[model samples]
Target: MSNTISVTLTVNGKRQTITAASDTPLLWVLREELKLTGTKFGCGVGQCGACTVHLNGEPTQSCLHALKDVNGKTVTTIEGLSPDSSHPLQKAWLVEQVPQCGYCQSGQIMRAAGLLKQNPRPTREQIVEYMSPNICRCGTYVRIASAIERAARETGAQS
Candidate 1:
């Protein structure tokens, strides 16, 4: 008997059905099964935020969520953030030049997107607190914060 089970969930605004072991982590599901590789896998233990994704519109560590846990739920990877990389954060990220090595950028951007959704104009302190979980080994923290602030300012004006 196969312990694997089928799970159906919405990813990047599309419904997808996949079969895998119940205990499989969502990070693997997104990368391997769904071919959504933007959500990185920095650490399997979730200490790092490189696997962050939006689950039901909340920033969640994909490495910590199992396939069974996310069944029927909605997940948004970096690809879903914007159809043409036009999300304010994306634009600001470029203007601010947030990435160095670029490995952790997608996760960082996803986390920042969640923060903005909750608080469109977060102060530097709030941005630091909210983004503390995601690590950028390239030491681009300043640029990351700047981009978030820029995105917040730009989005706030539109709202």
Candidate 2:
């Protein structure tokens, strides 16, 4: 009885079939298997948002998501956010210099992308509320929020 089973999912706009233990976290599958290393590993208990990715268009902690639950789902990592690092958020992050340690920036950008997908123009309060889960040891929250705001403005001017 092999615990390893084949699970197929769409990753970064590409369909992939993976074989791994059912209990293996999506984070490992993404990093070790699929070679998408932008999604970093932090707390691994879902409290820290360093491993955030878009699972079925929702920001999910990949470390907490098991391979068994991810079959047929769509995952988008920081690499998928832009092929040429041209996404509004990426440009805004550069403009705002949001990364100090650069560990949590990928997850932060992914979460902000989710927020912008749900709300194109989020207020400062909304940005804070939405992004509170991600922790930046470098204490770059202000710049993160500013980058999000800049991306929102570049994405669209909406209330």
Candidate 3:
């Protein structure tokens, strides 16, 4: 018998229902079923942050989270950050030119959003430490950090 099952969840602020194996990774469901392609697929083992998404307001690796795990949960992809790329982080990213190859940026941004939510005014050290897990092969660490700082400032994040 097929193991596909019905799962309902909220993605990008919208309710959705999808059918798939219970263990199917959330990444595939987001990309293949829900059509939220902003979350990229990287190392697939969750080591890389390319598939990062906010799960119930927390940054999570979509590649590792199973479809069943996200049932009735809320997920926010890069596209949901801001409809017009107007999030402070997005604007700061543009101002600081944080992207190189641009493949890992969505994950980076999502993770940064989570960080800012926890610590709105993280210092440079904290920014680096918190963002360490998200790798950028293009070596744009400096720019990324700068953008995050700018974002924090623009968003009126308290020091």
Candidate with best TM-score: 1
How many pairs collide in each candidate, listed in order? 0, 0, 0
lDDT of 3 at 77: 95
| Candidate 3 residue pairs in backbone clash | none
TM-score, every prediction: 0.97, 0.96, 0.95
Provide the RMSD of all predictions against the true structure, rounded to 1 decimal: 1.3, 1.8, 1.8
lDDT at residue 15 of model 2 (Cα atoms) = 97
Q: Cα deviation in Å at residue 66, candidate 1?
A: 0.8
List, residue by residue over 75-114, the lDDT tens digit for candidate 2: 9999999899999999999999889989999999999999
Higher-scoring candidate on TM-score, 1 or 3: 1
lDDT of each: 0.94, 0.94, 0.92
Candidate 3 lDDT (Cα, whole model)?
0.92
Global local distance difference test of model 2: 0.94
By TM-score rank, best first, the candidates go: 1, 2, 3
Clashes in model 2: which pairs? none
Per-residue lDDT over 1-159 for candidate 1, one digit per residue giving the tens place of the 0 to 100 score: 338989999999999998999989999999999888999999889888999999999998999998888889999999999999999999999999889999999999999999999998899999999999998899999999999999999988997
Q: Which scores higher on TM-score, 1 or 2?
A: 1
- Model 3 — TM-score against the truth? 0.95
Stretches of model 2 off by over 4 angstroms after superposition: 157-159
Which stretches of model 1 miss by more than 4 angstroms?
none
